[model samples]
Target: MIIEIKVPSPGESITEVEIGSWLVEDGAVVAKDQEIAEVESDKATLTIVASEGGKIEIKAEEGEAVEVGAVVCTIDTSVEAPAAPAEPKEKEEAPEEEKEKPEAKAAEEKKSVPESSEHDKVKVTSVAKEMMKEHDLSLDDVINGLKRLGKKEVEAVVNAPQATAAAIPQKEATRDEERQRMSSLRRKLSARLISVKNETAMLTTFNEIDMSYVMDMRKKYQQKFVDIHGFKVGFMSFFTKAVATAMDFHPMVNAQIDGEEIVMPQFVDVGIAVSTPKGLMVPIVRNAESKSIPAIELEIKELAEKARNKKITVEELQGGTFTITNGGVFGSLLSTPILNPPQSGILGMHNIVERPVAVNGQVVIRPMMYVALSYDHRIIDGKDSVGFLVKLKELLENPERLFTGGKDAGELMLGI
Candidate 1:
């Protein structure tokens, strides 16, 4: 019996998905519930699992776009019949011609000329092909070179040899052969970013926060927190707590414009900006104020993993009251982060380095991180935005106050 397999619905609002990769080869026996392929959806990447144990035949290939419930493969589960003893299969001998293929490829890569296809030319990337065309090199030669030394060697040939006498005929160079299917998530990202650009009077305001206190606190408690909760306590927890405190204090910063009316959210659903192969996704941690530092850390880590694996849901991506993006992980010294739509503000965290500072009129080396809060200028006034960031900085610099809800709110936030 052949069991037909179809693409499963990944999440809400995702009607289609791009087949990203196949984990098992055709005719390979896969166990029931074994992950066989990965699909990229608007919400996240989902693993296509085997429904029944069997040898499979694939109808879909990698990088192909398929719709939900579309038949993608067939699983055969037929009983094997007895047959006569088969002859011993001899191992194939390596052809001498094939053995020299590597040396040929290497020689081709070393060639200063590029290749053009006379037989249905593989339109190489523009720059590489152009350089080759000018030198009147054959596509077979270039491909052979690529096969020998790989693309990096070929790239060096294309990039370094810009000095070819400009004699190549001008070919209308608009055709592209690299047909990568865009994931649903990427399309959504484009649409949302365009909406933000067109619909909102977005303006970015910048400020730097000193992470010395936050860093020290993490160093002080990270190991113990990890040991107790089975996950390391991270700066994100402190930042989220600080953002929640600041939002509670300056409700305006948490507010967004609803055309004729201003919409203010009483609950703090802080969106964490996580970068994935699909791009930047901000998965919100709803009502972050209620979660402890350990809980917050776990939730953020889980959400980020989901985002990477393409297991995130549309609901998880929606309803972000505010966003926090940390560029520090990528070694960004400082950056002005863009606003994620509907939300008025986004926080940008940067890499920390010890800088000279005057503390009590004395110079000392203190570890510091620069922070930025970009806001929609139309709704968030300069004073409120700046003041809100100041509040964030103050809480972060003294994280104990974040647990205590700033200097005046005491430790009521922690329910202690």
Candidate 2:
């Protein structure tokens, strides 16, 4: 029986997809549930698997766009698999010819001699001449030395590209240009970015946080935290926890504008913007307000890995109340991150640099990171945006609140 393999829906709004690449060749035998092709949609790339074990017949070529539910290939389950071919048997009567192979191979590998006119004045030794003759080498193969020619020198010259490459001057290659079609995800990203700019009243507010506390905390308790949680404590966890807590005080930043109504969420679901090879994917951490720092760190790490490997699901990419993107990993000093559609706010974290600052009226060098919050002005006012960042700054600058509601760090660290 032949079964048709149709393109599966990648996401809610996705209707068509371009065949990214066929994992199996036409007429190739594939096992059930084996990936046969990757379908690229506007949102994500999905793998199409063989429904049952069979010989596959590709109906759609790679790079061709096919609508959802359209047949991409057919599997012929009725045909039996072909038998493996037998290996060749070794011959037994080749000892004599094998002995002469070394001499023949040496002759083939020997380099060509220079013109006789070039080395006529150079004296050739009898032993060197015989050795060169046996190896099909020449006088040019011998390097000039204070002593007589040697067999080793002749062998080195023969191994050098036979002097053919050295004899000719090669031309330098010119730069060439090649073009490829835009991926559905990239195209969609471009359109959505433009739509976001035109449709929303976006405003950016910036603040600087002293990272000394977090750095010191991580340095002192990182090993202990890892010993208990199996993962190191990171700055993102602190920032995520801070954002979740700050949202309660500034609920407007955690709200989105739907049509004419402003929808405020009861729980904090923070989206982490992960940069993947395919494109940027934002996967949400649901109920981040309730999750522990170690739990948030583990979930973020897993989600980021899945996004990078193209293993993230459509459900994972949906419904984020707010987003947090760290351009710091790529050394971005400062950047105003754009909104991830419908969401009212996004926070951008940048690289930390040591700079001289006034602490208690004294100049001191401290690690500082610039943070920016871009929010929709439609529902969030300028005061709310600035206040939200200020609150985040206070929490991150003194991050002990994350572990204890403002208690001693030693007690909390010991408890963990």
Index of the highest-lDDT prediction: 2
Count of steric clashes across candidates, in order: 8, 0
Best-performing candidate as measured by TM-score: 2
Per-residue lDDT of candidate 2, residues 131-196 (tens digit): 776765666655442377589878876676545666799888989889987878888899999999
**Consecutive 10-residue window with the lowest summed lDDT within model 2:** 108-117
Q: How well is each residue in 304-336 modelled by candidate 1, as lDDT tens digits? A: 998887677767877878999989999999888
TM-score of each: 0.71, 0.73
lDDT, residue 125, candidate 2: 70
* Cα lDDT listed for each candidate: 0.80, 0.86
**C-alpha RMSD of each candidate structure in angstroms:** 13.9, 9.7
